[model samples]
Target chain A: MEVKKSFEEINEKIKNGTAVVVTAEEIIDIVKEKGLDEATSHVDVVTTATFSPMCSSGAFLNFGHADPPIRMTKVLLNNVPAHAGLAAVDAYIGATETSFDRDIEYGGAHVICDLIAGKKIHLQATSPGTDCYPRKKIDTYITKDSINEAYLFNPRNCYQNYDAAINTSGRTLYTYMGVLQPNMANINYSTSGELSPLLNDPYLRTIGMGTKIFLAGAPGYVAWQGTQFITEVERGNNGVPTTSAATLAVIGDLKQMSCDYIQPAVFEKYGTSMFVGIGIPIPVLDKDMLMNLAVENKDIYTNIVDYSVGRRSKPSLGKVNYAQLRSGMVTLEGKQIPTTPLSSLSKARAIAQELKRWILTDKFTLQEPFKHFNKVSKLNTLEEVGKGEIDNE
Target chain B: MSKKAYKQRIYIEAEKCVECGACTAVCGAKALRLDKTTWKLIYNVQKCQGCMLCVSACPSRAIKSDIEDLPSAVAAAL
Candidate 1:
């Protein structure tokens, strides 16, 4: 691989307002029309994005010490429980934490989004008072302006690839993938295909730790590799993973976020989750990078797993590419199944365009990763000692 | 059915609908369907039986009946 244009050169072009930025979807047409040589020389960066429900998302908030500061042992914001083991007035609210008062409709994700929308939230905490800070209980209302620090620290988001789900059983299945009709009447798949971040940078060449990204409406950074991240997966011919692959642990300032990008949602029989907007700019440092960005939905494939199975490794019916999945229908076992996307492509495209604007306006700049992620990780299954035989040898 | 006669219609808020097809899946009637070409939700009010399954099945709460909304008030006024 040859470096056609360096990051410094791209940054200089961006600063001079001369950089030619295109989205991952837009780059395909450019490459197809002008060839790789022309596309490589003309484009500076390709923006990729995804807006979907990410379950492993939450924020670590530090509420400024109150008068007669009490160490918060149990923290509840808007009746949703938050992890308070960190420190006094500091807690972590997970997105999927359901509200104790409002049942499954409202959750920690709602609380976070409401706070972003400048809504007042009831804050209550109980503690064992100490001599230094002697306050047992307190009740008060707080807004985003009153908080000291609110930063989203998501553990697993921007999944490199994912599987479409269908129900093979006789009963309807309500899952994180959304509701699936029994006997494979409907298919629910996620991930903004062709426009997803990791899919655009399959080899992790440009994206890594410390890379700046569009987190909801605010700028964020990739903190580390996310949970259940497995790099070694069966990939397609285009070097993109065919099944679930890499993930990202991203962090950003929640104060600068907006409700338009970060939304709260509830799955019907399941639980609460969050819909977050994420965008990443992949620098076209070389022709290979341009070629990767040139990859289209037809080139990316994912397995359709049976959600009716209540197990980690569900049975995969068959492989279907995104082009077919996006077509709203796919045939399996000689039956036509109506398919719908869980991730919003229109919103994803908007985020990509917004990130592109930020770069063009000099409001944001791309950063080279300080370190790349390891490509050898396996998701091991936890087995009960008595229920299943242990396989850790 | 006369033109002036009030008929119930299902309305889906575009902003709230993610088009996950859950409503179509739960709809026992053939009223709610996803366009095979565009993957968009298409609701047929005539085929609906006032079951309100989609309205309840919608996780985003984006669906509603026109007869139960402002349309009902208009019908009463007329």
Candidate 2:
């Protein structure tokens, strides 16, 4: 018998979910080798990321009531599901929230999602400040000596200084609020020390209504465009240009989240009344491998499969465009590691099952199990977000 | 009881705006959008209930209102 797993088997695994973490660079490697489909044959991939200068773990640990982390993960995972055939995955947090607390540090990656989702209503200190309360001297950077001497010099005054610094940091400070492809591309270039398709072809306008972009981390640019068209830079899927199997894994994780959380709320908020923009990063797909897999699994519909493309990856066209093309958690392995690795497929299914249980559990007490919501006027026509229609015209 | 006067006025600075559309996104009165002729953001001030959501959501902080100018304008119009 062949050792390969079937779609149904893999689908079952995704229904139950967990943190299927990988890096974006790794997916590129997988595409170059396996062609994309074979590599992603099994997995539910999405981007769940945290920013640097901060550890994602510490942010989760400090989640005021521990609900922010759960709410954040739940929101990302709700975008992807196997049955609907939409690709979606949880982008992992790259760093902790503390790293973003520095003065002058406008904000970090995770904070961006919160900003878009309306979770984090206020912007905090990105850097620290100094003051001249007693002597009226200028206060600037935070130093090791200052850290050690804070208490010794004046404990109460130290609190005063820190509070003043924290408050002042938000004043007149500017940052990119949402996911901007160009900005994302720039950040990726600086971090990975590599050039990306998004930066080189900065003018490509790729977007589609079927895709809903998730910010794995905080505000990098202005704000979530909340509309489909981005002009100053490329549209969605602007940065990534590697055909890889790992992209499938990333899509799988993201799809699960799409179905579970984002679909309902985004549909409600952006629905029929107003236009909304989604900033998606593009991923490579091996057309041949994808065709073969579907052919091999003759029972699956091409339409469903095509729709599923929106899960972890984006189809290089449409108004819900791709931008700031940057990499996710997957590292640049020669044969890119599957974003939603076949091995980790079961983990995703488990998570999905747990989420279903939680949604039902909370429904009774909260009346609405979903957390991230916008109370827009009652003109909601979209039955679901990132699904509705593409209007291919 | 203390006597009080109610008024409303809206102002926008074009330079700072990025046109994120958050105002139109949440406007209960359907009074905001990018003006087609100039692409400058505009609003139907009359339809606005003064909820100030647009005022709050302006990412660029370019929107302002004149409480004093509104009542007189409304009274004069009436």
Candidate 3:
């Protein structure tokens, strides 16, 4: 396919309300009817979206100093613990962080959600009285507006693809994948299939640092390669990984986020996590980029993993396409297992539609990446080295 | 009466439930309640009429009808 318009030309069309924009769902059918050449010629942008429970998510808040300005070393928000390792007024509250009072239900995710929901949260802190900052004890009520700076700087948010979990043990297992029934009675899979962020960017060609994104109702950017990024994972012909591959570290202003997009979730046995609604618009730069956006449920696949094993590399029962997984049943070892998704597809589609509306109405604009991510960056695994082994290396 | 004469009731899987209170809102018999102290959903088996409303209402698929000697497929999985 020949490239007709440059990125600048597309941006000009976008600004002038002349560019044709379609969602990932819409483009699939468009590409099917009209070949890649025609699709790329007509469509200038594709909006991809996903709403998943990302555990490695948190918010950095700079709660403005109190009357006496205490150097807070320990902080609690609505009885949920917040990491006070930052400066005196700044604290980072992790999504999976649990409270000492109610460990399972109420957590840092809940606190963040409550703040987004416009609820007042109790803030408590304790610190040793120092010379510069004397006040040690602090007790106050704070809301999202009251905080000076509240932004979500998640180390990892969107995963390329993930594993479907099943329990092989005789007893039921409570895990982050939800309740995995014993003997593989039920399987829990979490992914928006074609709408997943990294899946749309497959080879990481367009999505990189400084890429504009719809982050929980507000605009955000791709900060860096997310933690535990395994870019060398095996891929299919479509360049989409069949297993867990790349991830995106995202940063957004939490104050601009709404309660609808950024929700706090509590997994039964897995503790607390947050459901982040993210939408990324991919510019149809070339035929390759267009083809990556054309990936469908049939083309994407993931492993049905046996979560009974306690290691990171759990044994895979077999690989199943998202088409089979979305059908609500997949045969594993000749046994039909019922599948459930922790992520909501309806919400994902809504986010995509919302982003599409934003782009069309000139409320949001696409951005060219300042620098692309390193595709050859290797993810290292932890290993126990022998005494003096580090010196030898 | 024989010991087997008692009818089977609804079972709430505590581990599977996220305590969203969806089941409690849909229960016509008032058989389910969320415990405030522990934040766990409590199932009153006696009040449960085996309506199975809570089973269908549960978002996480945590509630199930516990019928003994039933068909394996129905009893085994949701």
The per-model DockQ list reads: 0.33, 0.01, 0.05
Compute the lDDT for candidate 2: 0.24
lDDT per residue, candidate 2, A283-329, as tens digits? 21223322222211111111101111224332321111011111111
Interface RMSD of each: 2.9, 18.2, 11.2
At residue A47, give the lDDT of candidate 1: 96
Tell me the tens digit of each residue's lDDT in model 1 across A1-393. Answer: 444887788888888889999999999999999999888988999999998999899999988899989999999999999999988889999999999888778998888888888899999999989997799998999988998999999999999989999999999888888888788888888988999999998989998999999999999999999898888999988899999999999999999997767788788888888889999999999888888999999999999999888987899999999999988679999999888777877678788999999999854778999999998657886766864666647
Root mean square deviation (Cα) for candidate 1:
3.8
Q: Candidate 3 - CAPRI tier?
A: incorrect
Please report the candidate that would top TM-score against the real structure.
1
Question: Candidate 3: global Cα-lDDT?
Answer: 0.80
The regions of model 1 sitting more than 4 angstroms off are A1-3, A386-393, B1-9, B18-49, B65-78
Taking all chains together, each candidate's TM-score versus the true structure is 0.92, 0.22, 0.84
Chain B TM-score by candidate, in order shown? 0.70, 0.59, 0.68
Docking class of 2: incorrect
Higher-lDDT candidate of 2 and 3? 3
Which of the numbered candidates is closest to the native, going by highest DockQ? 1
Fnat, one value per model: 0.33, 0.00, 0.00
Native-referenced DockQ of model 1: 0.33
